[model samples]
Target: MSLVSPEYIRYFYYGAIVIMIPFIISDLLKKKKEDKIDGTKHFKISVYNILIAIAMMVVLFFLINSNYPS
Candidate 1:
C-alpha cells in the first residue's frame, strides 16, 4: 500500500483548511476590535494568511493530480 494515495491527500487538503479557519476568524475579529491606526497591520496579516492558504491549495492540487506508480 502506498502512503501518498489520493484519498490520504484529499484528507490532508481538507485538514489544512480546517486548521486555517481559526486563524482567519481570529484575525478578522481582532481587526474589528482594533482602532484604525492598527487596522493596516491586522489587514496585512490577514491577507498574508489568505495568500498562504491559496498557495497551499494550489500545491495540493498539483500533488493530487500528478500520476504516480503505486
Candidate 2:
C-alpha cells in the first residue's frame, strides 16, 4: 500500500550515508584556526556520528528485510 518500495528506500539510505561520510571526514580533518583548537572534539563527534549511523543502518536493514515477503 505504500507509494514507494523498500528497495528504493534502502538505496536512498545508502546514498545518503555515502554523501554524509565525506562531510564528516572534512569536519574531522579541517583546522580550527579561529579558536586555535585541535581536532579531538571533532574526532569524538565524528566517531559518535559514525557509530550512530551504523547502528541505525543495521536497524533499518533488518526492518526492511522483515517487511519483505518470505
Candidate 3:
C-alpha cells in the first residue's frame, strides 16, 4: 500500500503547467526588446528554448528521482 498527499501531486502537475506561462511571457518580452527581429524569429526562438527547458526538466526530474552518476 502507498499513500501520496493530494497537495504533493497537485504541485508536481500544476507546477509544470504554471511554469509554461512565465516561459512564454519571458520569451515575448525578449523578442519585444529586440528592435529588429523578423516575424518568425520570436516564435522560433521561443519554441527552441521551450523545448530545451522541457528536455532539461525531464532529465533533472529523472536524475533527482533516481541515483545517477553515483
Candidate 4:
C-alpha cells in the first residue's frame, strides 16, 4: 500500500495551484499601485509554483495510472 493515496496527492496539487491565483492577482494589483516596488520576485515565485504544480500533476497522473509503489 502507498504511504499516501494518489487521490489525496491529486487534491493537494489542485488546491495548491488554485490557491495561488489570489496571490498572483494581489501581486499584480500591488505592482500597479506602486510603480517603484519590484514585482519580479513575486512573479518568479509564481512561476516556480506553477512549474512545481505541473510536475506534481504529471507525477499524480502516473501514480494513479501505474502500479508503481508510492
How high is the lDDT of residue 51 in model 4? 89
RMSD (Cα, Å) of candidate 2? 5.9
Worst 10 residues of 2 by lDDT: 31-40
What RMSD, rounded to one decimal, does every model reach? 6.1, 5.9, 6.9, 6.7
What's model 3's lDDT at 6? 59
lDDT of 3 by residue, 2-32 (tens): 1567558767777788988898788678786
Task: Score candidate 2 by lDDT.
Answer: 0.70
State, as a TM-score between 0 and 1, how close model 3 is to the true structure.
Answer: 0.46
Error of 2 at 47 (Å): 1.1
Instruction: Indicate the TM-score of model 4.
Output: 0.43
Q: Give the best candidate by lDDT.
A: 1
lDDT of each: 0.78, 0.70, 0.74, 0.74
TM for candidate 1 is 0.46
1-70 in candidate 4: lDDT tens per residue? 1356865887787888799989878986675555547534665555577689999999989889998676
Model 3, residue 65: C-alpha shift (Å) = 1.0
Ranking by lDDT: 1, 3, 4, 2
Error of 2 at 57 (Å): 1.2
